[model samples]
Target: MPDKKLQLDIRIIKFQDLIGRKPDKPFGYYGLGVQYMLSGKPNMADKLFTQALNIKPGYMPAILGKLEVLLAEKKLVSAARLYQKNRDLFSGKKIYKTRVQRITGSLYSGKFFYYYLKSIRSVFVFNETIGALQRMFNADRGNPVVNLLLAMFFLKEHKENERAFILYNLCVNMEGVPDKLRWDLVKVLAKDNPDILIDEKTAALFTTIPEGAVGEPYANFILKQFILLKDTDKINQAFAEFQKNHSFPDPKTMWQYIEFCRENDIWDSTVFACCQKLIDYGWIDRTIAETIVGLKNRKIIEYTRGMDKILSLYGYI
Candidate 1:
């Protein structure tokens, strides 16, 4: 049997070929084009996507696919033109506006950034996204979503630690950002930028900020609490309480657990737990797992070795 990746590629190729000849159903063409793109055959995918648009001039998925391909290729101007062309198609303009908003939306940006990094290999594009977010921040300083997106962009680009902290704090303090996203900022900052720990002054600034503050003042307080306490057990317990009392823990919570294990030199158990979680989520990647495992200390190795048996007993491996 072919490996999973190879089989996926074959299926994508077959889907593209089937749709290319028919050209009757816009969805088939769109789906096929996306499949081809996922399989790394963007040239063929672009042709199929264009064919879909020609068959159904106002179709969305195909147009978006074409724009994505252009963006992936670093043809930003072309992508912008395509977006503009299709921007007026939907009735009442609400539908089109909503689509644009969704794509550019703060909630969507984090997931978009992840896929953007995966799809494009160019550091230039990454830098451009960060720059765009920065410009947006300057113009709309009160926009919480923009602030959150900017923070995420900086994190992705490995920018100066202070910039990340500022962005993160803005997101956390910002009003009207769903509690879920604010929690995500906390997890990301805690794990990735622990070295740039929050200080008392920062905490105080957040406290005095009003409730309707676009960005809240509580973020620094939270960070300061973490720093001064320096109690990992307390932090974890608090996180557990937050998760239990509030809404469901998002993906970031899981990431925080993995990161916490890493920061305290608990590699083996961390890797094992991370591996088990990834496997459960169907995201197991041997190469990534092996690299993380290899980076652990001796004690971690021993602890993880014991965890291996525990996972096996539970059939989690």
Candidate 2:
């Protein structure tokens, strides 16, 4: 995911340039107002929206944009007043009327505004603007989107739990799936929440490998879903099929690779091949020679005799 703060700054700069170039046009001001609203700055956004409306009084985008800022600031009374004042304006066009109805709903429910800002894919401090997302979740316990949002916020706050996985999970917003949190979520699901079937959206997360990573964070997860087949032969076939696309991205060191194999009870040529590919992949920071002889762990090393043959080639005991 892109850096939200940085993306906001870039948009502000772009709109400022547009304003500089076309001060009399409402479009520039309207656009700038939107950027400010998303970054949790309702006051600045409101002023810019006003400038846009001042330039073109009938401009529907600016009209709606200003309403959004009002909503964002939780100035529901002011928003209501502004909304009713423009009631005729909304009735003037089918699209305009639809937009007005949406905004009007926000006056009575924070859920409306939450969905509103979410529809636009902008930054929204829903916790500050409307109320805590948890409150939204509490009120609308059956809403999958809100459930997902609450989980994302929890993940953002470093609160991982099985409840998140159990929710009728749609694709989680990538922004919420922090790299540090990925392993925990994956492990929790893979090890603890076996009943929670992995959704495609959740499984797609495994492919986001960070460069030069030191452990196989995603080693054997592709085969996790196969565990439900309840047949070793079918599970093995699934593993073989999965290997066609997946490679071990973690196991940053030989010891990690060895440990991974031991944990999975996978002592086979495929394991050695993956280990070789890691070295040949030229991604690890250390040379193959250093890795071969690096940090000898006798217990982990004893997992396979192939470890001895490989280490002996590098004159490592």
Backbone clashes in model 2, listed as residue pairs: 215-250, 215-251, 216-250, 216-251
TM-score of every candidate relative to the true structure: 0.37, 0.35
Top candidate when judged by lDDT against the true structure: 1
lDDT of 2 by residue, 206-296 (tens): 3333222223334333334233323345344434544545643333433344444455555555545555666455433333334333322
- The per-residue C-alpha lDDT of model 2 at residue 4 equals 89
lDDT of 1 by residue, 20-45 (tens): 67758787778878877777788888
Ten consecutive residues with minimal summed lDDT in candidate 1?
205-214
Where model 1 places Cα greater than 4 Å from the true spot, the runs are: 13-21, 77-85, 88-317
